[model samples]
Target: MSATQTRTGSCLCEANKFTVKGDPMLFVVCHCMNCKKQTGTAFMSNVMFKEENVDITGCQDVGQYADSNNKSGSTILRHFCNKCGSTMFGKPDETRKTGVVYIPSVLIDGSDAWTPTKEVFAEKKCSFVKELVINSPQ
Candidate 1:
């Protein structure tokens, strides 16, 4: 994808909106227990991008929680909308890029433009979801 491509997204209530000015650096699906609990789903579709390349707005009621029990052991700030209780994004301190921000793939403006190459924390994935996927990528 070109670095110039732009993407925009918002929370369920549209109270927290944002724009990614450039292409994402990485995309993945996480089946970790914490991720599933946070999203209330079987897995989390996460997208990574340079923080400087993304823009945000309409966050008057946004809130965050410091998550420290993650795989990296480094503290991650989980940001979300306070009003709608939507999982918006996260900031990872020990990942490959410290300046990169983690966004939910559902927030991306389009579907065909983004694809998660791999899934993580498969060991913790639910049994019911295990029989669904094949030949995962990275």
Candidate 2:
């Protein structure tokens, strides 16, 4: 595919570069405990796209962490760049056949057009998180 047809991005150290064609089919903010720890923040901004649309053209040090306690009851394969330790995306273990590449929004190159249209695992969200939105004047 032509470079202009895709969005290109890389890990913090630029050791791993990737490209995704087209916008995500789904965008979400996850507040599950695992998300907090995975992102080292209150929540994680995720952009889910069809797996075949994404291409990690360069990377030999991709690391993976299989999470067994996921709410979906399916093992979550969290993939990241081992060089800079940047958490990139995730996929449900082969058995689920979800075919979705759950990528961290910040890792996707381009503008800030992406926004979470949904939030999941709200019960696990920190109390302060609600205040930020509720207290907003919007």
Please provide TM-scores, in order, for all candidate models, with all chains considered together. Answer: 0.86, 0.87
RMSD of 1: 2.8
List candidate 2 stretches off by more than 4 Å.
Answer: 1-4, 131-138
In candidate 1, stretches whose alpha carbon ends up further than 4 angstroms from where it belongs are 93-97, 131-138
Over 12-114, each residue of candidate 2 has an lDDT whose tens digit, in order, gives: 9988888888887777888898888988999888888898888976756799999988677779999888888899778988888888998888887772666
**Location of the lowest summed lDDT over 10 successive residues in candidate 2:** 129-138
